[model samples]
Target: MSEPRFVVVRNDEEQYSIWSADRELPPGWHDAGFTGTRAECLAHVDEVWTDMRPRSVREAAR
Candidate 1:
């Protein structure tokens, strides 16, 4: 399996943020109702790679 890529995005209200681990996620995109503690967020990032699509080296390097 490949490693995960992560990006942080803030909600419209800017009250909280989510750390997305999928390579396809665009900048500034936010998911709803995805709250987690700091540690949970890190764990989510680590595990997300298992379910996320693998990115090519070129794609990842970009």
Candidate 2:
């Protein structure tokens, strides 16, 4: 089978979440702050994902 895909969604200031295409939000998906900037949020997301699994273009979608 192919690997899972994840989507990072920002809801409000200092709030964000991540989910898989075929699943609900995973643990630690929203343990970080939004920081009011795309770069900051993405950086935190990258850090969070790095601790769990490697990231790939195919694994992250809108």
Candidate 3:
């Protein structure tokens, strides 16, 4: 079997999630463009997804 591939995804609320590279992205969600093994993808999210709040909330704070 082939190795699993993962993609980091985010929604409008700024929630980060991992998705299968071979699976279809659901509506209203888009890829963050980070792809790799599950661990790598999660690490990417940890490095970049520092803020857990939604975009709107973050913007409001700014």
Candidate No. with top lDDT = 3
Clash number by candidate, in order: 0, 0, 0
lDDT of 3 by residue, 1-62 (tens): 96799999999888899999999998878998899999999999999989888899989999
Stretches off by above 4 angstroms in model 1 are 1-27, 50-62
User: In order, what is each prediction's RMSD in angstroms?
Assistant: 12.7, 14.3, 1.4
The digit string of per-residue lDDT tens for model 1 on 5-61 reads 444443443323356454444455565434455566656555543423334443566
Please provide, for model 2 over 1-62, each residue's C-alpha lDDT reduced to its tens digit, 9 standing for 90 to 100: 84444456543232445544455545445433334344545666766554342344335642
Give the poorly placed runs of model 3, Cα more than 4 Å off.
none
Clashing pairs in 1: none
Model 2 clashing residue pairs (backbone): none
Query: How big is the positional error of residue 19 in model 1, measured in Å on the Cα after superposition?
Result: 5.9
> All models: lDDT?
0.47, 0.47, 0.92
Native-to-model Cα distance after best TM-score fit, residue 46 in candidate 2, in Å? 4.0
Residue runs of model 2 more than 4 Å from their true location after superposition: 22-44, 47-62
